[model samples]
Target: MASVSRVASRILVPFLVVLGALLWLVLGAVAWAMQPPTTEQLATYLDDASLAARAAEARSYGNHLMRPELLERARFKAENLSRQNQGLAPLDPEVYTPPAAWRGMPTTGTVKVLAVCIAFADKAPVTPVETIRSKLYGAGTGSGFPYESLSAYYERASYGKLHIEGEVLGWYTTSNARSAVTETTAGREELIEEALDHYDALGHDFSQYDNNGDGRIDYILVYWTGEHGAWASFWWGYQTSFWATSYSVDGKRLGDYSWQWELYSWPSGSYTPLVAIHETGHALGLPDYYDYDGNTGPDGGVGGLDMMDANKGDHNAFSKFVLDWLTPAVLSRGRRAVSLAPSGEQPEALILFPQADGQPFGEYFLVQNRWRVQNDTPLPTDGLTVWHVDAQTDGWDYLFDNSYAGHKLLRLMEADGLEEIEAGGGADAGDYYRAGSRFGPDTAPASSGYDGAASGVRIDDISLDTVATTIGFRAEAGPGGLPTAALGLLLDE
Candidate 1:
C-alpha cells in the first residue's frame, strides 16, 4: 500500500506541473492579443509627451512673410536682373527649367555670408555677439545644449557638398526706434542699407562677400534684438533693394538677405539656431512648407514635421534634392527592392514616378528614411517619410490667396491614411510608415494622380531595422522596364 501511494504521488506531481505551465502560456497569448497595436502605443506616447504641442508652439511664431507668392515673383525678377548684370542672357519667361545657379544662390561650394547684429534704439540686445557666432559656426562641442550650429545644420543637410563660412559682426545700433523700422517695408529697407553703410565705412570689402561672382553676394543675415512687432514685423528672407534697383556697395551687388530675431523663447528659453536655419533655407531657394491659409484650408501643409515648416528637425529629402545636394535612385517601372539609409545620415533617397516616362521634375513621390538623430532629434517619431511632389506647379501655389488652384507643390503622404494633417492636425507618430506597412492603389490614400487616375506606383513590405529601411516597389506594366543599368540617375546637374 505504501509503495502504491508513493508512485501515484510522483505521477500526479509531474502532471500538475506540466498543466500549470500550459495554462500560463495560454493566458499570456490571450493578453498579448488583447493589447493595443504598436501604432496605438506610439500615438499614446506622443500625446502623453506633448510632442505635437511643442511643434505647434514652435510654429505659432511665424517664420516668413504672410504673402510668399509676392516674394517668389520678386525673386524671379531679381534673378533676371542678376543674370543681366553678370552679362548672361536673361532666363526666358517661357522656360520653366533653367540652370541651377539661375534659381538662386550657388548650390555647391563654399558660400560666404555676412551676418550683421542690429539693436533697436529703444530695446537692448539680448544675446551676446560671441554666443551668436558660436551658434552659427561652432562644432558640436560647445556650451550650448544643441551643440549643432547653423553651419553644422547646413553641412549635414547638404551632405558636406555646401559649406556656410561667414562672419557675425554687430550690435550696431539702428538710428530709428523699433516701432519706426518695423512699421513698413521701406523702413526695414532703410535699416538694412544703414547697417551695410556702417560696415562699408569700416573698410569691410563687400566685394569679397560675393562668393559666386554672379554680381551679387551669396547672402546676408541680420540678427536684430527685441520682440517681433506686428505681422509685418515678422522675420523673413528677401533680396536687398539692389536686387530690383541694382543696388550695390563697394562694387558688390546685394542678393538674398534674411532678417530674424536674435533669439526665440519657445521650447527653449535661450537663443537657438532653428529659426536662423529655416530662414537660411529660404536663402537657398526652398519655400516654406507651412500652409499660408492659417489652417483654414483643407490641409495644414506638412504640419511642422519639416525644418522649413515648424522650424524643427532637419531638412526633408525633397528640400535637399531641390538644392542639388541629394541624388535619389529612380524607379519608373517594374518591380525593385532597395534599402535606404537614414536620409539625415546619408544622401540616399528613392523617387517613384506614376508614369514610366514621367519627367523627373514633374509629379512624383519621394521616399526617405527619417530617424530621430542629430538635428532630427525634435521629430516625434522615426520611419519612412513619403512626400508627394509636383515640381511642375509653381511653389507660390502653396499660398492660400494664390490663384494657382491645384494640389500643393509639396504634400506629406501620411501613412495612417487619416489625412489628419490635412484636417489641421499637428504631426504625430502615425504620420510615418513602419514595418509590414504597404502603400499602393488599394490603400486609403491610393497611389493615384491628382486627376484621380490609378498610378501604378506601389510601395510594399516596408521594413525598418537598425541599419536601414528596406522597401519593395512595383509599377504597372509598361512597354518595358526602366533601364536597370542607369540606376543611379542624378536629379540635377
Candidate 2:
C-alpha cells in the first residue's frame, strides 16, 4: 500500500508540471497578441516615410563629447626636439576663436594638411612638409575671381578685413634616418596624428565653426597630414561633424570646416582655392548648381563663373541663391539688417522670405529656399538670378530641391510682400496650402509622394537626412485644381 501511494504522488506531480508549462506558454501568446506596436516606436524602423517635418535638434550625444585642438608651440624648449626641425610655424595666432556672435567658442583653429613639396625635402623619409595655411574666413583664390586687381578682390570680398592671413603649422620632415624598414604610409600617418595632438592640447570648439550659429555645427575643415595619393579633400573625412563624441578616441576628427587642401597642388588644377571655397559653400548648405533649375550647367557666360559650374576661372563665385540662404543667419550675428534692399538701383535681388527650420532636416539646409530676380524690370544692370545675388556677397554657393521622394504629392508657395497667406483648401481630395506671406500657419505648406522625385541612381531617392526642410513642395490651386510649386527658403536674421 505504501509503494502504491508513492507512485500515485509522483505521477500527479509530473502531470501538474506539464499543465503549468502549457498554461504559461498560452498566457504569453495571448498577451503578445493583444498589445500593438506604438506609432513613434514603429516609425523609427519604417520602410516607407510619407510625411515628415525632418527631425529637430538634429544632434547626436556625441557632439558634446567631441574635442577640437590647438597647438601651443613654446620655442621648442627641448634641445633634442629642435634638432628634428619642428619649428616651421603653424597658422598664425596658433589658435582659432569664433566671432563674437559665436560666444567665445574655441574652434578648430588649425587644419593639418600634408604638403608634399618634395622640392623642400632634404632626402628620403626626411620629406620637407610645407605647412600651407588654409585661407581665413574670407580669402578669395579660385583662379582669382575676375576682379580688376587681387587687392580690389580682397577689399570687396573679405568684407574689408583683407589682411587676415591663414596659418601653416611648423613643418615636420620624416626621418629616413630610422631603419629603412619603416613604411612611408605609416610615417605619414604618425605625422598626421602628431599634428592632431598639437590642436587637441589646446582644446578646439565645434560650435564656433558653425557660421549660422545653429546649436549644431554644419560645416568643418579637416586638414590631413599624409595621405597616399588623394589631394586634400573637402568632402570626405571622419564625418566628425556627425558626432562630437568621435573626438574621444585618439584618431577621431570632425571634418567640419569647408576648405581642405594639401600643402601644395596634387595635379595641375588641384592647388587652386576653387575647390576649397566651393566645398565650404557646401558645408554652409548650398547645392550643386550644374544640376539645379532644369539647366545642364557649366553654362556659358557668367554661369561658368559660379563654383557649381566647375570653371577654373569664374567658377568660384557665390550665387544669389546662396547669399539669401545664409546672409541673415551668419551676418545677423553682430550686425542688424542695413535694409532688405542693398543700395543703388533698387539692388539686384531681394530676400522675400526667411525661416528657421526646427530640425530633422538639420536646422535650415532643407528648410529654406531662395528666389533670385531672373529678369528685373527691363533687367537690372546686375544680371540677377537667385544665384547671382549669392556671388555678390563674396561667397561660393548654389541651389537644390529634391523632396519628391517617399511621400504623397504637392506643396505651396509662400509669396513674399503679400499681406495674407491663404491655404486654398483643407485636406480633402485636392487641398493644399494657398498663397501667404512666406509659409504662414493655417495652411498646408508643401508635401511629397510615396516615391521621391527621380534623379539618377545616386540621387534617385531622397535621403532621410536633415536637409528636407528646404526641399519640399508647395501645393496650391491652379487651372486644373491643386498644383505644387517647389519650395525655396532663406535664413531670417
Candidate 3:
C-alpha cells in the first residue's frame, strides 16, 4: 500500500469512532455470508463491462480474504510464539535491525515495537558452529529458501507506510523442542498448545505498545519453526533466521550484517515478499476479494486476478474496504509519526443495498418491493424511497439520496432491518418504498404485462402490487464494504 495523507488523530474523534466501529464489525466477522448468483442474466450482469473494470478490486479483495494459503500465513502471524528457555542464555549483542518502513510512520499513544530475531551465529562459521547451527539451515537448489521471501514481505507491507505496535517474538528451540519432536511431525495439538502458551505467556502488553506507549497493536508478523525430528537443523537467527537453507547457505539470512534489509526471512525455502505482505494485511483486518470458481463461470474460472486469489489466478493491489479499515488502525497506532494537522471527522454516512432481483433466501425476497432509509429530517434523502422513477419528486424517485447524512444513519438500513415507507401514495400503498425495481422510470415504458407493469425491475420487500414496480434493483453503499457508489445505488442517505 502507498503512503496516504489521512491522519486519524488530527481528525475529529467521531471519524475514528465511526471508522473503528465499522472496521471492528467487518473484521471481527470472518464468517462472510455472500449470496451466489443463481439466475443466468444476473451472472451475465456481473460479467458486464462495468463490473469487468473492477477486476483489480475483485482480485485484491479475494487475496485479502479468500486465498486459503495467505489466510493460513496470517493465522501464523496472529499466533503468539515463544520458545522454551533451554540451558542457553539469551543471545548477547542482540541483532536488532529496525523495520525500515516503520521508522517514519504514525504511532498509537503507546510504545512502538519491532520483531527482532537472534537465532543465527556469527558469519564464516565453517569452523563447526554448534548449539544453534546445523545442516538444516541451508537451502536446496530450485526448492527456495525460507527467509528470503519473508524479508521481501515485510519491506513491501510496511513499504515505510503502515504502523504496527507489536513485536513478534522468536528464539531458538530449547531441549523442549527435541522432546516434543516425536517422529517427523510435531502433532497439531502440541503445536497449537505451544503457540497458545507462547501468546498467553507473552500477552499483549508489549503487543500493542508503540513508540509512544499506546496500548493498541493492530498487527504483528512472525514466522519460525522449531526442531521437529531427532536430527533437525539448528535455528538460524540472522541469515534466514530459522530457515533450513542447507541448499546454498546464503550468507544473507545467517545474520550476515552485510545485507541491508531490516527484516530477514526465517525459512530455508524461497519466499516471495508479496505473499508475506498479503498475509500480514489479513492480520490487520482485511478479507479476500477474488475467487477461483470451479463450479461456475467457466472451467478454470478464477473470475479474475487479484491478490486475494491464489497465484493460480491473480495477485497484487488492495481493496477499498481493506484500505479504509487499515487506515484507522495505522493512524490510531501512531504510524504517522509527524505532528499531524488537526482533529476529528467521520465518514458522513454509511449505506445499505439489500433488495435485489435475486434472493439468498429462496424465492421469499426475490420479488418483494421496498427501498428504505431512516426517516430522519431529509425524508427521501434520509428516509426510504422507491427505486427508479417512482411517484416521488426525485426522478430517481423510488431511488433515494438523503442529500446529507442522517441522525438514524445506520439505526436500520440493512436488508433484515430496513424500515418500510409508504408506496405509490395510496391507502393500500400503506408504508414502504416500492421494491423489486418496480418504480424505475424506464421500467414499464409503454404497456403493462397481462399481470401489470412487466418490467425488468421487480419488487423486493413491499407486498402491494399496485404500489410494486416489477423492475430489477440492487442496493448500494453499505457499511459492509460492498461497492455501492460503483453499483449505482446511494447508501449514505
Q: Put down candidate 1 lDDT per residue, 1-493, tens digits, no spaces.
A: 5554454333223222322222322111111100111233224434454323332433443332222432343335434433432345767775544443454566678877778888878877877777777778666336433325888888877889888878877889976677776545556667777888888899888887788676777688877777643222244322232334445788866766776666533122466665567667767766666553332333455765776655667888867765667766666555666677778778888777544344323566778888876666656777888887755525543332110224566678888899866655566678787776677878877777667877677777666676543333332322232433345332221
TM-score of each: 0.73, 0.32, 0.27
Q: What is the C-alpha lDDT of each candidate?
A: 0.59, 0.24, 0.22
CA shift of 143, model 3, Å: 20
In Å, residue 449's CA in model 1 sits off its true spot by 1.0
lDDT of 1 at 162: 81
Per-residue CA lDDT of candidate 3, range 1-493, in tens? 1111122111212222222222322112111111111223223433442222232322322222222222222222111110001112323222322223222113112223333222222211111222111111122122222212333222222332333323334442223533343332234223323443454465534323333222222232333343211101122111111122221111111110100111222232222232333343343333433221211121111111222322111112122122321121000000111111000111111112121112111100111112211101111211122212111112111111111111110011122211221110111122223333222213322112212433233223323223321222332111212121221121112
The superposed Cα distance between candidate 3 and the true structure at residue 108, in angstroms, equals 10
Q: Of the candidates numbered 1 and 3, which has the greater lDDT value?
A: 1
Rank all candidate structures by their lDDT, best first, as comma-separated numbers.
Answer: 1, 2, 3
Show where candidate 1 strays beyond 4 Å: 1-103, 140-147, 179-182, 234-246, 264-269, 294-298, 356-360, 393-404, 467-484, 488-493
What's the TM for model 2? 0.32
lDDT by residue (409-455, candidate 2, tens digit) is 11112222121112111111111111222222331232111122211
